[model samples]
Target: MDEKKIAVIGAGIMGISALRRLSENKRFLLTCFERNYDLGGLWVYTDQTENDVYGRKINSAMYSNLQTNLPKQLMQLEGFPMDEKCPSFPTHTDVLAYIRKVADQCDIRKYIKFNTEVQLVTPVSENTQDTKWLVTYGDNRKKNDSQVEVFDAVIVCNGNCSIPNYPMIDNEKEFGGLVIHSIRYRRPELFAGLNVAVLGASHSGMDICHDVSKHAKKVYLCHRGSKLPTFLPANVTEKTSGFKRFTSSSIILDDNDIIQIDAVIYCTGFKYDFSFLPEGILEVGQNGVVCNLYKYILPRQYSTIFFMGLMRLYILFFPYGDHEASYIKAMLEGSVDIPAYKERIEVIDDDSKRPWLYNSHWEWDKELAGIAGNFEPFQSALKKIRDHVLEVKAKDFSKFRLDAFKITGSDSFEIL
Candidate 1:
């Protein structure tokens, strides 16, 4: 078969994983565009004393307490296994290294064009041939700035963290002290000696509150309700026998109706920023991007374009991105038939209302695992999902012990 050209935007974890999988196929001619000099997106470490949009200076590479909410075992790629030397909860640096190692081991770096940002992706199809896409990128290295590339297929793995959402509260303008989005958050020192109020109550919210409470005089973790999972899923252990849970020390609320806070950190989460695309090409949900097909693999009209890492939930038994990539590859290779669904995914009515409010991480794990077709006893389907998670986990664990450790230490591990 003639090599098919493919373009992937963002060299982050999801993008790199997609690229790695695509590279395995000899017929895929792949090119990846990343805006940063390095591969890791949010996982990459930077000095907090450095000037950011929050107008605060980051004094360190990364906050000391930063850790992945998911255990290392669940985060690994299909072939890579975690090394025995590392801890259960791997740090941000450890995850970054693991992703970088995947790029190296898979020989994906040669295909990646770093420090290049994709400005626009336009689909070109008319009365003639098969559909193709024209990808336009901004060249950070060249003075000309405009660079153009085209591909047979485009995979958007940029992720949801690119754009941070700030709530427009009535008194938001009146409050004093520094207010910043979680994207700008690197450490808790900025909240030192001050009362801090945290909003959103997701994994990021929980993480920020946990970190700031250590240094801040007082920290108020405000939320509609806590939806975070207290443990890993039971199916993970029953299926793969590898999964762990990490618990938060404490999360307190304030009396003023708002969490008592001098500074407000909104770990409110992120959305798919596809504003660059034409309206007819894609549609986003109130809470996230809308998808009509099964597991969000196939779009209603755009069959050539696929979305990966759009789901923001516990991914214990199955790695959604890897599975999505596999399905896409099969479609490209003419193997698996794309499944259809009736209802399109919709966003939550109240953006502020936490849908995941009462649910635990373990619950999310079971739900996603079930949806990804991981629990099915069918050998082919089970093997695909199971092997994908295990490969990614093994590769991930080999680089970061914390990931594997989190699964081993979790209460779910004992139950499963």
Candidate 2:
């Protein structure tokens, strides 16, 4: 096959990893677009800046105690084992360093265009030509700021975290203290000495509550439903009982009948902003994702453009985004056959008001594993992942692991 030109939007963890895999094939001429100057997207550290949408300054990247929710062993890429000196669950900075190193070591940096945002992507002719996409990007440095590029295939690596989705709370505007979404969350210092109410019970919500409780007079970790346990076991000790969870759809009013809250941080999670794509090409679901695709990859109607990190789930206790990227890359390179879209798009709970496709981290992992034809029993899955990590460590970090008092961070490798 002729060397194909592929454009990847967003130079984040998933994008960098996908680019690395794509670089291995001499037949792939890849160009990565990032709106930021640096390689890391949300992971990169940045100072507080005024957010036009929220009308407030926020720490776009850094939080005082940000750490990976997954263990380092599972989180690291297949080849690069985490440094023995690194903590069990690596810090955000450590993850950032790892991503930066991968980009440099794999020589993907040369193919990337920083400070470039993808404005629009259109299918020139639906599945008619092998090269299916005419992608347009806006160059931030240019005055008029527009450029066009064609790609045989386009990987939508721009992840779900960029767009914030706030639930419709009754009288939200009328009874407000300080309402901010997770995107605007930087640090918890502003909530100090005050009553802070946090919404949602996801990983981000947990992190926010953990931080706010340290300084706030009283912190209320509020959620519409029962709190889901962290996928990974908690390691915090009894000395630090700073975080607490509460289930409440509405907050209690004050004596004066004012919906009193010093501040409310909605860590309810995010959705994809696919408005840039043509309506017929991709249908946005009520949950704010392209609904027609199976496993959140190939669209029901279009196969050329694939979504890499649309689903959030744990398969072998690893992030599903990276796995999705790997599968997409393989499919694009003709290494694997594209799976059936609708059959794989699992619909759970048809009785509910809104029927949602099951795209949780665990479900995504199993689906990808099944698609890859590397199916294993749950126990064997753990062992296989462990063996892979051990193999990488033996070749790459044998001396460090043996000499240092380091333990493998996770035992959930078999699920991958």
Top model by TM-score, which number?
Answer: 2
lDDT by residue (1-416, candidate 2, tens digit) is 67888888888877887788778788988999987778877787654545423232222445657776545655666667778778755777898898888778888899889878788898888645343788888866566689887888888777667677776655555544677787777776888787777766556776677777777777665555533432311221111112122223334432212223577787877777676676775566564555656565776556677777654433332334556666776777676776444443443212123434422334446557676552321333444454554454334331222222233343333221
Work out the TM-score per prediction.
0.73, 0.75
* Model 1 TM-score, 2 decimals: 0.73
Candidate 2: segments with Cα more than 4 A from true spot: 49-62, 127-131, 227-259, 284-290, 314-319, 339-416
Residues 228-294 of candidate 1: C-alpha lDDT, one tens digit per residue: 3332222111111111111132212332222334576776666567765556555565566454433
lDDT of 2: 0.62
Q: Provide the RMSD of all predictions against the true structure, rounded to 1 decimal.
A: 10.0, 8.2
Q: How many backbone clashes does every candidate have?
A: 40, 9
